[model samples]
Target: MKRISNLLIAFVAIEHILFLIMEMFLWQTPFVIQRFNMTEQIAKDSALLAMNQGLYNGFLAAGLIWSLLIRSYVEQAFKIKLFFLSCVVIAGIFGALTVKISILVIQALPALIGLVVVYLSKPQENYDVVI
Candidate 1:
């Protein structure tokens, strides 16, 4: 379960990194414009805002990655994962409410699944020695 949770968390983190690249580096490109369903004019108009939003996504990705890297303490890791995943879920909900329903599916669903897996997983058992 922890493996699954970690994999899901990593997946979401990579996803956000990709989003950051597209929004920040490719915001005005035709492919990005098509992906976001924006007209050229609108994409140009909102390029700066998209870059800022992309930076926030980068932070989200960094937090999740940081959670994964802190392996020295099990309890601390669990807390970090929970906190960052919760943040993602909340942001996804807010984006869905204000921008698009797809945000709920694309952003929130994976984090929610990771949250549930982490919640139900037995963290201590992983370190138990069977003697």
Candidate 2:
């Protein structure tokens, strides 16, 4: 289970990193337009907004990495994941209602699964105190 969670977290982190680059840097480029079906003009106009959104995605990835660390505030790691995943879940629902059904599956489902795994896994409390 731990292995699965780790793999999922790693995958999500890497995937979102690429998304961050695409949305922030290559948004107006042909790659994202061809893939996500957005117009180049719109992508260019929204670059800054997309970059902001990408930062949130990066935060989610960071939270996952933090949970993997053994230092204090490990519990805060889970809290961060849960908070962001919950936001994704709500956004998914809104997307399903207003934008498109695919975003729900593509964006939200994996996040939900990852959050569930992180929530179910017991936190590692073992730590050495150096004097």
Regions of candidate 2 where Cα sits further than 4 Å from its true position: 71-81, 95-98, 123-131
Q: How would you encode candidate 2's per-residue C-alpha lDDT over 55-91 as one tens digit per residue?
A: 8777766765655564356666556656656666676
Q: What is the TM-score of candidate 2?
A: 0.73
lDDT of 1 by residue, 1-131 (tens): 77898899999999899989988999999898888789999999999999999999999999999999999877778888888889999999999999889999999999898888877774764443121
The CA lDDT at 41 in model 2 is 84
Name the candidate that leads on TM-score. Answer: 1
Q: Which stretches of candidate 1 lie over 4 Å from their true place?
A: 125-131
Specify the poorest-scoring 10-residue window by lDDT in model 2: 122-131
Clashes of each: 0, 0
Residue 92's lDDT within candidate 1 is 92
| lDDT, model 2, position 68 | 59
